[model samples]
Target: MIRFEQVSKSYSGGVQALQKISFHIQPGEMAFLTGHSGAGKSTLLKLISIMERPSAGHVFINGHDLSKVNRKQIPFVRRDIGMIFQNHRLLRDNTIFDNVALPLVIEGYGLKAIRKRVETALDKVGLLDKARYYPNMLSGGEQQRVGIARAVVNTPPILLADEPTGNLDPKLSLEIMRLFEDFNSVGTSVLIATHDLGLIARMKYRTLTLTRGRMVQDGLEASGANGVES
Candidate 1:
């Protein structure tokens, strides 16, 4: 679960990306962050991942207060949270299996465990046969699937995706969403940052909309209950 109380983020160059934002995401719940460019969706994700710190209040993940979390413990916290990126961020030199196996390998998981987890992750993403293929050898959709596999390989309790389907077609985007839903059904908390309002409109997940770096609305679905203004 994620809880942000009066959180604010101001970059070094004096640009304030988030302004007193506050919200709570329940454990095992799935939500989408909706906003236009510079609306602070990515900033929110970064705060939860400890990629950046808040200029103001607190950001709590599960029971950990991000502001009070130690530098040495950031890694341990991150291991329980998975992240997916817009570009997949796969290493061009590594095969799909290697890429998916990176997290476990980094965690010092033995070869056997890595192999089994990697295979299972790839199978879930429908990319088992492409395991031996390199990033350049797969289509955009396939590459993203590999990224998904990499994120879920560790069975993290929370999943944060930033524009994960930004590069894929609508059909592929739907497929990826369904995959996230499946993961959520198994108890993983999912927070997806996406600007695709149409794609989000079709689903019933809670929708958080932001504008001018502040939360404007938190709706239960496509309902008119949530909207913040510029």
Candidate 2:
């Protein structure tokens, strides 16, 4: 579960990226984040992932307050989260299998276990046969799928995607959305940040909209409200 209580983030130059934002995402819930460019969507996700700290209030993840998470415990806390970026942040030199297996390898899992998880994840993304292929060898959509597989390879309970379908065509975007839904169907808490209004309308998921770093609307409070245009 994710909870933000009166959270605000300000940069060194005195630019505030988030303003007194508050929301709670329950376990096994799937939601969407929508806003215009520079609307604090990325900063909010970073706060949850601990890439950046808040200047005010608190951010709690799975019952742990991120404000009190020490540097030594950061990695352990991050292990419970899986992040997917808009850009396919794949290691071009590594094969798809190795890319997806990196997390397990970092955790010191044995070869057999890493292989099993990597293969299973690849299969889930419909790319098992492409395991030996490198990032440069795959299509854009395929590369994105590889990123998704890598993120979920370890089965982290919370999934955070920042503009996951930003670079894809409409058809491919729907396919990628469906993949996220598949994972959500299995109870992985999902929060996706996107600017695609049409896609948001089609999906009909609870949405949190930000405006100039302030939370302007939350679709959760209104039944059947997709979201207001940012």
Candidate 3:
């Protein structure tokens, strides 16, 4: 579970990216963050991942206050959260198996354990057959799936994706969303930041909308309107 209490973020130049944003994502829940560019969606995700610290207020993951977590403790905090990027950040020089196994390797897992977890993660994304292939050798969808596998290889309880389907076509986008839904069904809490309105419309999950650094709406599509005034 993640909770933000009157969180605000401002850069060195006094450029405010988020203004007193507050929301709570319950355990085993799935939600979407939708906003235009520079609307603070990515800033919110970075706060949860500890990539950026909030300038004011607090952010809690599971139960720990991230504002109190020091630099040395960030890595351990991140181990409980999985992150996916739009670009599918992977090592082109490495094989698919190596890319997905990087996290476990960094954690110093045994070879047998790494192999078992890597294969299982790849299998979940339907990319087990491409284990030996390099990232450049795979299609965009395949590469994204590999990224998803890498994100989940550690079996993190929470998943955060930023513009996960930004570069894919509609068909591929739906495929990627389905994978997230599958993960949520098994009890993982998911928070995705995206600008794809069509995709958001297709999914009935709760959505929070941001504008000019303020959270303007939060509701579900089933409640008549996709979002209610905040």
Candidate 4:
């Protein structure tokens, strides 16, 4: 559902984040993006979400050309994409339910609909019992689960996670990955940018590897010896 054709991104001061990178992620696919620090994983995700425009080439989300989508259309495009980050980006002052409800609230859903959707999303992430709790009241892993719940509250067609399990313990990381797999099994396209090669190996999904801002590998079962620094 996501495609990048001959994409290149360059920043000020001669920084090249990506160079002629291209890939296609089909509907219902789950893939891992691997690379060292500054390999442009986040930059690529931003392009797909229309948060940052590519310096060159075209980015297609679902079927819409992102370059052609105007400012007024970004929110509509993002409605079909859910994003999760490494930091769990929760509001400390808000309860879990409120945090998860933010998207539907912004979409103008009524209280009843928001309540239903938030509860369902929290339940899916095994956080139904903690909906009333604040972020500080939960463990690191639980907080991450809350972030996942918030991202999927709208049941978006695509899920993009950046270093999602970066801070969790091995067990908790595995649990988090399983959650992604569950969502993917039900047909949500998933693309995760992670540094955990062991986890990637265990999951055995298609992986896209980047090095120095170029796509070096895009195939099934990335080898441990692929020479990816991350």
Which candidate achieves the best lDDT against the true structure? 4
Per-model TM-score, in order, reads 0.96, 0.95, 0.95, 0.97
The candidate that wins on TM-score is: 4
Name every residue pair that clashes in candidate 1.
216-227, 216-228, 217-227
lDDT of each: 0.91, 0.91, 0.92, 0.92
Candidate 3 — worst ten consecutive residues by lDDT sum?
Answer: 221-230
lDDT of 4 by residue, 80-193 (tens): 899999999999999999999989999999999999999999999999999999899999999999999988999999999999999998999999999999999999999999
User: How many collisions per candidate?
Assistant: 3, 0, 0, 0
Instruction: Please give the lDDT score at residue 207 for candidate 2.
Output: 88
Give the better candidate number (3 or 4) by TM-score: 4
Model 3 has an lDDT value of 0.92
What is the descending lDDT order? Answer: 4, 3, 1, 2
True lDDT of residue 174, candidate 1: 98
Where's the lowest-lDDT run of ten residues in candidate 2?
221-230
Model 2 Cα RMSD, Å? 2.1
- Model 2, span 121-212: residue lDDT tens: 99999999999999999999999999999899999999999999999999999999999999999999999999987888889888898878
lDDT per residue as tens, model 1, 143-195: 98898899999999999999998988999999999999999999999999998
> Which residue pairs in model 4 clash with each other?
none
Model 1, C-alpha of 68: deviation from truth (Å):
1.5
Runs in model 1 deviating more than 4 A are: 222-230
